[model samples]
Target: MEVVRSSIVLSRGRSRLTVTGVLTGLLLTLSVPAALPESGAVTPERGSAYMGMGVLAHDGIARGATADSLPDSRTGQTEGVDVSSYQRDVAWSTLYGSGVRWAYTKATEGTSYKNAYFTQQYTGSYDVGIVRGAYHFATPDSTGGAAQADYFVNHGGGWSADGKTLPGVLDIEWNPYGGDCYGKSKSQMVTWIRDFLNRYKARTGRAAVIYTATNWWTQCTGNYSGFGATNPLWIARYASTPGTLPAGWAYYTMWQYTSTGKTVGDHDRFNGGTTQLKTFASG
Candidate 1:
């Protein structure tokens, strides 16, 4: 720091700059951005994180495509939605009346944040006869996956045998606050994910659904396929088709096809019809 300042001061005379201008410019250039706060600072804010909140923010959304444009996209499929604290009070009855059959609400993030609207979104979905589940937005850089999983399960991410509740989802995608991969290598990422999934199933006696965009998964996990058999895939693609999916999965269990739903929160499609969705919920 001293050497750099000395060099800047030495260049002041040659560059013909005033001392005040030089010092001010140097400090301004070195200052950290206000938008990207330190993790310690930002986590305390307890911000809401919906499914694909990080994915959409970090990964570019597919252009010139809407779910309706694809003729086969909605034919006989069960509809669903995923919400978070951002959704505040969701209209679950309206969604259920409009052909929605299932829902997932954001329950936790990292080991610090829990969605304040989780009870309303989660219980309301159930009350309306929409199969409901909870999701945890993962932040691998902040804490261990198992620890985060425990935090999630403790804070409304737990599954039940009531048949109206689906297994909790692990919303692992792009990191919205910083580097996309959360600073982990492909292998490290797989390990972290494994820890979370294992802990979730062990805790709840059911495998958690894994939600992610294909590009982000490829970049972070090197398209790891080992989890496909145990964890159901919830692929996020804003376009008509799910496009090429992340490795391991033969077919997506759920597709979060549109982030912009008509006032019902982010809409999704269960790859199968209502019966299959019920069976999935029972499991």
Candidate 2:
């Protein structure tokens, strides 16, 4: 994480995120307040943010025994999907009918890397009325954190919401650059996260989400209390059951329980619950 300063303004309608600070190259988060509900529409909670919007800032480094399984519903409308360039060809209408109420599409990475489907997915998800967010995969060795943040804010497009825009996330998973980029060294990583968050907050007027895998949480990112209350978390763990994570880990709003998800509009990806979605939409 790099070092920067910022403030956030949450929307209470439309569930979109916005910002007003200098954009950087690192991945980050943004939020908004949902507007009061109208007929046939859901209203977002005033000044409330969803926990599932949190993104894992790194790859899976979780070890040891998994927790006991929690009762999970196989079919529902609130649960969402994550798609990338590979799945661009999939029809968006299939997702709308399949109960995908929300979605996050991969936008871009580095100078040359871009998710081919982001443009279509962003518009398609909005048209279908599914809450949508964007994410960028960041590497410690590749572009600097600020650079990645700039790419995301500039290319990831805009957010519109009363509670929050789909969270801007930094996917800190596998590092294409070997060495410490994937090994132990919290100082630089934490600095990178903080920097990204600060720059994004300054530019977006909202807190940014951090996405990462369970294994990476323990291996790289430890208890980062500095994130404060505004930051939400998204945890990725491919497991048989979903519940509390490790003792050091806090409660996540969204849990990616499975990667090989059999969803209507998505390929193999993490699947999780959206129990509080209505709450986030309530005024």
Please name the candidate that would achieve the greatest lDDT relative to the true structure: 1
Best by TM-score: 1
Models 1 onward score TM values of 0.81, 0.64
Worst 10 residues of 1 by lDDT: 24-33
What is candidate 1's local distance difference test score? 0.74
Per-residue alpha-carbon lDDT of candidate 2 for residues 14-68, written as tens digits (9 for 90 to 100): 1323222211111112222222333654433221212122221122212332222
Worst 10-residue lDDT window for candidate 2 reads 21-30
* lDDT, residue 47, candidate 2: 17
List the RMSD of every prediction in angstroms: 13.1, 17.1
Model 2, global lDDT: 0.50
Q: Which segments of model 1 are wrong by more than 4 Å?
A: 1-46, 66-73, 261-263
Model 2 residue runs over 4 Å out of place are 1-77, 162-164, 180-184, 243-249, 261-283
For each candidate, how many residue pairs have backbone atoms clashing (under 3 Å)? Answer: 0, 86
